[model samples]
Target: MLSSFFTISLKPVTRPIFLYLLLLAVCTGGTTGELKAADNKALAADRKKVDSLNQLAFDQKRFDVAQALNNLFNAENLAIAGNYQKGLATTLFYEAGIYHQNGYDKKALATYYKSKLIFESLKDTLNMAIVNKEIATSLYASGQSGEAIQLYDESLTVFTKLKDQRQIANINNSLGLVQLDQRKYDIAEASFNKALALSIEIRHQYGEKKAYYNLGLLEEKRNNFARSEEYYLKSLAIDRLMNDKFGAALNHLQLASIHQQQGRSDASITDAKEAYSSAYVVSAYNLMKNASARVIDVYRQKNDILRASEWQDSLVNVLNMQIANEKEYALNFIEVIKNQNAKNTNAEKDLEKQKQVQKEQLLIITVGTFILIIVAVLAVLALVNYQRQRFFGKELKQKNEIIEKNSASLDQLNKEISHQNLLLEEDNKTKNKLLSIISHDLRTPLVNTKGVLNLVNQGMVPPEEADRLLQLLETQYLGTTSLLDNLLFWIKGQMDGKEDDKVKVGLHQLIKVLEEEHRMPLMKKKITLRNLVDRDLAIVTEKEMMRIVCRNLISNAVKFTNENGTIDITSRLGDDHCLYLAVKDNGIGMTKEAIEKVNAKQYYNTTGTSYEKGSGFGLMLCRDLISKAGGELIVESEPGKGSTFTIRMPLS
Candidate 1:
């Protein structure tokens, strides 16, 4: 009589408590041979029947499997006396599957995770892998391809270890589908090929059909029409052999699509019709509608208005049928939902009762625990503050001592820095005085020597001896002049505190005058002068200072150029209306070392090409004058190549 009661209670409940009662009853059953056999067979068959019903419910889009499984799970709990581990795991799996089919992926994922934890606790690796694969499928369907691939890989590893080739092939096929979604064509193709080979080896017809279908889709994506057609046909053959009418219809539809892309309109029409016929046989409303639409397009393109219109009407009818089917599915879904809601309502009430009981117990415990914790916290706080105050006092004393020592040291350092600054100022004043004296005294001798040489060259002395004397005097005069000019300008720049007097001057005219003045000297060296200047170019600068800069640059160019060497002077208007002047000379250029020294902020001297001595003050004067004029002096030179000096000044 207890066995009878247990069997009756195992009829599936809508509440959770019955789950525990069922397990207790099953364990308490002291049954011998017949009762045990009957119970085992009934349990196995019961699960199988539920699974079959669930699949049907899903296919028909009922979406009530959650409520159904909850009821079954409750009954199983009662039957197993709350130890319905296997039944609960299976129910959760089916419930998640239902949510997945109904497009409630988030709910499905949560349920799958719940089921996963239970399976893991039970150490059921096989069902765990299956649940993982289903979860991956759900993820892939929801456009989470990357995550799906990782899950599929993990599932495949387990299946491979179990030596379950058929299951591995299924995982491979799923992985291929995800790869296809990700546009990873090569990997997709390899995965499909692996699945196909394994399926063929095991003669797993469903796996082979799926693999071929995936390969066809991949080929179609790649625009390999011929290969796509071949795979579609292979998949169609397998579907036909297995009597899978839906698969057959899908295959024909895909082939028609390929045919249309290949411009085979008649073949496309024929294939599309075949797809419609197959779809009709299977009552696949969506596929029939798609095939009819394709036929209408094909006929319209072929200029068969009558046939196109007929197919168009057929497409409309199929669309209406599809809508009706969807509405019917929606109605059934609503009914199933109403049933689920009724079950959930009852469950909620029971859960509320349990929660109220738990809340009352928890509140009492929490109040007592809170009182104890507050007292402990107050005790800890007083001890922590006392220790912190002791540590802070020690820190304060150390900081005070360090502050006093630093203050004394800083005062002494300040006094030493002040003394050093005074010495540096005095040294700078002495250097300035010396530079001024050297500049003035040197200029006096150079001017006197130049005047004497000029008289000798003008026949105030014997002509034969005059040439040698004049050359020697000219060399010495140039050296002294350059030294005095650079020294005076550098010293003045260091000491002068007045604004430079600026005026607008035609740059081209100034350059022309310099070129003419240097022409005689340049000709003596056999240097050819090429002037490329815009006559309209003008700049604002100090006239006297600019003249000195121009004279120095031209003189240096003339001195450096070898016999028959070319010297080009170019002037142009630059960006921001700046006048840029460049003097280029093909000469015995200075080495990198000499160029570096010449550019330094120190006195650097060198000899001219005519064995003439130079104080290197020419470039220094040029640099200072250009700076005072708000211009830049740039030089480019190499050891063997020529040099170019560019002066950039703002145009007026």
Candidate 2:
């Protein structure tokens, strides 16, 4: 029977539970290469059984979702108990597909993500691509076409890289559907045509059928009914050849609509009855209901009340059966909800534990620093007493002798006190810099990312806005990563005694990275960013430190620059065997006082021309890093003019 089924596998199972069954049957029919190494026959047998159950459930999914869901839950539990990751992911993916088909879009997205994460962790790129494609489909249906297309492109890229022609064809077909809905007729046709070509080349009848069907829809939208009818007929031929009753039902219903629109009552009725019979045999109640309604409408139009009445009774029965099936599905899907809730609870607990550990570590460090400061102050007081005693008189010679006897101890304490003072100052600066960066730059982007993600998850972001937000999200993500890198480098330099790892650093490449990181800001202000540094310009310095300093300078430029302003980054050889790298912005310049503070290595707060906030500690951090790297920072600015922040680093 299985061999016979395989022989007729000309039709591709697309967007239906039947596809899952076909995949599961093929996968479980033999020892999967993924698990063939398992020496335990019993374990393999168990996995096979689990796969079989999934296949059986999928076979019943559309007609009896309740029973199918129950089977899926059992499969999920067994996979969990056996630690069968691939099986578990497969079950979750199928379950999500069911939820999507049932109109539970949000639930489906969540489940799809869970499956995707598992596939990612497993390094199963193919499965991850598959899940992403499904998620995009759901997004498209939910009217989030922009986000959907983004996801579709991401999936396509992966599929393309893997050279998976089948998935590639499928993605093209899906993209065509989205473009069709958007009424981009030419683009849609191109997409469908590409999918068709790929499918025909691969002999993927299922993909071919879908491409034809979508092409039909596109023509129908263009009011080219004759062309549409031809496409539907081709698709219908495939459905019949594949013995896909559900597909036949769909084709017949479309044909009925076209015939009715053409004012051919008899033809419409014939097509409608064929659709109803096809759907009835497969227990596809929804299609049956639609087809029956069409037949009833045609008969009533012809004043055949008896015929309409007969069809009306059939419609009522279909509706009742559909409702019953829905209720059953709802009852079983609750188990899935409970499982998801439990997982969420566990995740929340883990997050809370992590937060608690971070808080405790911070508290410990803060308390220890406070006690060290107190000890340092006490030592300073004793040193002052010793100085006064030495200056006072010979009357305190007895005390003088004791002090002299403890002179080595006092000297050691003095050295420690000096060291502590330096450390305390550096620690204080680090604390201020970290606090400012976290409160201002880091926090905003993270919050924005979270807000955008939440909006996406809730399906509330509009297509145009979502596109903009996606760009913002990417910019914010990269900026956040760069900022964190800077922080880590600075922190490491402060804590570690290792010298700067000097290397040949390309100034042009460095500036280019900063340009990309600040692209959003530059674009927002319509600023022209010119990287005038020579492509081969190189400097021997700590790459990360140089990166941090340069990032701050470019960021400040973008901040201060007004709309339609220009910012130029230029590098030249200095007279002192050093490189002069200047970031010059022609917009709102800094005041003389601000320039003085910057040149003097002092921290001061200032806002951008657009009221963009800054940490005020960036320049200070840059100055410290540059000074350690045998470099100097110079600031030149005046009110209503442009500003230039230049770094002079030794050429060696």
Candidate 3:
């Protein structure tokens, strides 16, 4: 008993098979969607962990940096296992940053380039451009400013192509700083101005801070301390408001240098101390290094020996701590490798023992199996000979059957050859007939039109006579167009067999249109044409094909019909649900011999009762169109009477 609108579908399967399938689905992700959803969540978690670790390492926090490195290695391993290439590259990049921080510049640069290459292969333009910028900065620090400038130009080109305003501004700002170091003041100013303009246009707050800082450095290089101070303070305000510790630290360091140069010892000392504090907050090592030296200089100028000595000792402590960190990092890496090698040695020993035991057991089993195989081989050989004899007899019978099949095939080949020969003969005749018409029916009209146009162009004819010639040309043109249409249809049908677009078509309406189409021709012959088709007599056939057949029949009738002759059309749907349409003309009829030749498809150009010339393609075309419609043409006529062409097709 089931509710009308509710039904439970039943599947016929055993409970054990169903449970196995369910287990298989869970393992193979055939269950609806949750597998990918879970994978995406895990990937997101992995990415987030990697980003966090990278941030900690960037801040240079000692305790957190070690943990961050461990987490980053784990993330890289996970990314590799998941086949996440981009994530793997990203983790590698951060790992390289950690190496750079530990003062392993060679390893850091190598890893950075490898990650950059990966981004390039992936065609990730944004990440590739960023990695290029970082590589350029490292090169500049290594005193390869020329190579660094080249890489910077490459990155700038990529950023400009991307139209990323913030990245472009950042690249421009960095390029200006490098140019400033190289003492190219004009180029540096131009780069800084471009950065500032772009940053303002896009409202990039951090990029604006970078641009302002670079501009300040440029002015300070030109000995314009007043202008430099204004730019530095403007950048410092933006950095503080945005809480960018690195930006704020750099601004403080630049201000300290400016003050020291201006002979303001007390103010320079205050700025240097503040810059050192900011370095600690943002892991700004270079700023802290410069600030330390600045503090010593300011104290020495004031004759403060104790404060200068203290600042010098602080700088030495920073260098010593870095040396100690690098030593520890190297020792830890060596220990991990030793432990892994020891584990591999133990596993190898266990595997060798297992192999030795398996070898002895395999030897014993092989001897027993070998003895059994020999006896089995003899028995199989005896059986195989018996089967071979039987197979030979069967093969002989199959050979005879195949021979008989070949003989039948050869008979069919002979018949097909004869049919093809007949088709070739008929095709040659058609080509000849087509050439005759193309030369006379086609070219004659064009030549007449050309000659008449020439006469008109030369004003060789009287103006009144020119109008009559034009009328004659128009009639000839219409006739040529009609002939071309028919010829095209004939060629297409020959190349690609006719296809059907079937629909119900009323015979009365179709005949009425055809009668209107040839109304002038009928009037010339003084023929009274009547359409006796019932309005309801519709046929299910291709309309265009059927219409063409009927038009050809009526045209032929009008060609043969004498003056004052009558033509009529009639149609019916029989009880068998098939349509029959008849076109009759009371005119000079075809002789039985002539009709037989036409039925045999041997009709060619011939004159009608009025000696009207034609290609005789109409009757042949009627046969072809009717045959394609899956219908047949039936004819009834005598020499003294008239001809009736009837089309029999299916009714809708």
Per-residue CA lDDT of candidate 3, range 229-301, in tens? 9999999999889987777878888888889889988888888888888887855566777889889988999
Per-residue error (Å), model 2, residue 582: 86
lDDT of 1 by residue, 413-510 (tens): 99999999998996696577556657764766767777777887677878877776766566455546555665665567667585567888787788
lDDT of each: 0.78, 0.85, 0.79
* RMSD of every prediction: 19.4, 31.5, 28.2
**Model 2 lDDT, full chain set:** 0.85
User: How far off is residue 106 in model 3, in Å?
Assistant: 1.9
At residue 91, what lDDT does model 1 achieve? 65
List TM-score per model, in order: 0.45, 0.45, 0.44
Those runs of model 3 whose alpha carbons end farther than 4 Å from true positions after fitting are 1-63, 280-292, 304-652
Off by over 4 Å in 2: 1-56, 332-652
What lDDT does model 1 reach? 0.78
What residue pairs are clashing in model 3? none
Ranking by TM-score: 2, 1, 3
- Candidate with top lDDT is 2
